[model samples]
Target chain A: MASAGSMAAAPFWRAAGMTYITYSNICASLVRSCLKEPYRAESASREKVHFSVSKWAGGKPEKPNFVPE
Target chain B: MAMAALRKEGRRLVLSSNPSSFARSAVFSEESCPFGARSVSTQIVRNRMSSVKNIQKITKAMKMVAASKLRSVQTRTENSRGLWQPFTALLGDAPGVDVKKNVIIAVSSDKGLCGGINSTTVKVSKTLFKLTSGPEKETKYVVLGEKGKVQFLRDSKKSMELSVTELQKNPLNYTQVSVLADDILKNVEYDALRIVYNKFHSVVQFIPTISTILSPEVVERESESGGRLGDLDSYEIEGAETKAEVLQNLTEFQFSCMMFNAVLENACSELGARMSAMDNASRNAGDMLDRLTLTYNRTRQAAITTELSEIISGAAALSH
Candidate 1:
């Protein structure tokens, strides 16, 4: 009964999967462009920093000896 | 247990009655004759072509899966970016701070075949190791994911402090990062913690990034109260909580949040890298298949022409 039910729902499952893929792809591109604009401006002036830490502590070292820029 | 037993029984039944497996061995033996050798070679080429086609199908499916996953991961990272900015601004900067000990948190994923994402983090950690030097300079590593763990073990086994691998089994979340943060804070002692991860730039670009979290001493030194009070009193804390204790709790909270963000970014980058890598694999496999099919057709034609010429010459000799 379980196998038969799953088989009957296969097309629905496939459709759901396709919808998910499409939705994510769209969302990703939206976020990417939104992120890219500011990132481009920041990169133009400063090197891209990927690491994140709480800024509550005194921030990064005065002079980063190993800046990968 | 019942499911496992049922699967075993089904597998046994298939193996006992599978005629195709028997026919394959028979074909190999029969095709070893001199007359059938050319045909056998052609058949081998055809088999290879079919296998390559199957692989191409798999890689194409994986590429699609990665593309789908990349979107959600990217969205999560983007949503968290707003929260990240304000907290970082509040912390400000610490200048001329020195470190007694350093901990490097190398973030990566368990899965491979994602281009050079993992290697880039490892390389950055190595570079960090080179830059720090002093009498009290002690460096340790807390690696997330099996790939990073293995690479660190191979390159710098001595510096490895702890490794967590099972985290990548599920989609990354704050709970996981909180647990990790608690473990690092409790077990490790360091003046500064450096997080190394691959920052996603685009579908095709990801760069290794290193961010630092300062310990209380370093923070105190860099903060305004430590002789350079530059608007330190501007923001007042409510209630009767000691500033030190408040900073401690906030540090842990920020660490986990930042770690979660890093994990999300790395996950997105990994998916993007995998999608591109699989796409390339599928294309290469298609090219190979085309070449193999052409070779197989040429071989078959040559065999046919040779047989025809032999038959014609024999007919001519018989008539003479």
Candidate 2:
């Protein structure tokens, strides 16, 4: 009876320990993603588009005769 | 010693024999009649300390919320880049496109305490206007958010055509941008539309940027170029009228997509700026609390010393 009771309690303790470990892993991953650079690097690369008016104009426009609207 | 017990019982300890002593003690407890100077100042300092602590709690909570929000805003901005890329590529290096009238859309948020996020966008808009606009350019302004509107009103009230306020009260979405785009298309006529916004570089850095959304005239100019026209020739069109209609729809879609991307980028920058600002505020509040706590302890000690000396001197007089 003593062996049987101890054997049953051992699995319960192991399961509780496993749950705590999983919780800690989730928390650590979240902190790493928020604070680190690799996640930002991927997003930053996707945002690289050269959209500028000065480039489109091929430099600055000359002094056109002032025509007021 | 005889008067000390009365002083503790919420009564003024007026010693008639020593008029000067009465005057001195009276001056100390003028307002808090029973409590002396040291305890009264200590009470005031304690109240200030508690209020500062409450402020610190609020700022810390704000910092956490902004951090969580920055992540989601950054994701949205990244995802929307694909939608605007092809549109910009098709209108690449537009040549001989002279814009007679230009409209600037300054995108900022209504909230103020978020460091230099809004001011940077306003400053960039002003600079762009000065660089590109002339007496003949007929530049108009469409100011978004109260902060940008107030800034523009102070300097360029005549140029401001329409102002949109309170758009940043909630997290912005594509639907709101579509409505704003529709309003602009209906009310404003321009040769080109320029968008000024803050771009999030990092948690601690943001850059004010400007992007021009080309008008149909500019797009037509680009399509006439030999190099770009060859690129456009790859697409098979059934009719000239159908092509014009399709291009018009594409232009509207591109405008909304660009606006959506700009708002998302600005929101992320705002959150990043607020997070750092609140972090600094919480640190400053903590420093104030420390200083106030030190003052409180020193004042209490001084009061204890004074009271002990008074009691000993009174006992000595009695013995004599």
TM-score for chain B of each model, two decimals: 0.83, 0.79
Cα lDDT tens digits for candidate 1, B161-184 = 766655655566554455556656
Instruction: List candidate 2 stretches off by more than 4 Å.
Output: A1-69, B1-40, B93-98, B169-171, B222-246, B312-320
Ten contiguous residues with the weakest lDDT in model 2 chain A: A49-58
Q: How close is candidate 1 to the true structure, as a TM-score?
A: 0.70
Q: Clash pairs of candidate 1?
A: A55-B91, A56-B91
As a whole number from 0 to 100, the lDDT of residue A65 in candidate 1 is 19
> What TM-score would you give candidate 2 relative to the actual structure?
0.67
Tens-digit lDDT track for model 2 on A1-69?
A: 434433552333233442222333344445555655777664343322221110001122223221111
Q: For candidate 2, lDDT tens digit of each residue in B131-243?
A: 76776777778777778777876778777766666565445655556556655665578877888898778889888877677766566665776566447656876433344
List clashing residue pairs in candidate 2: none
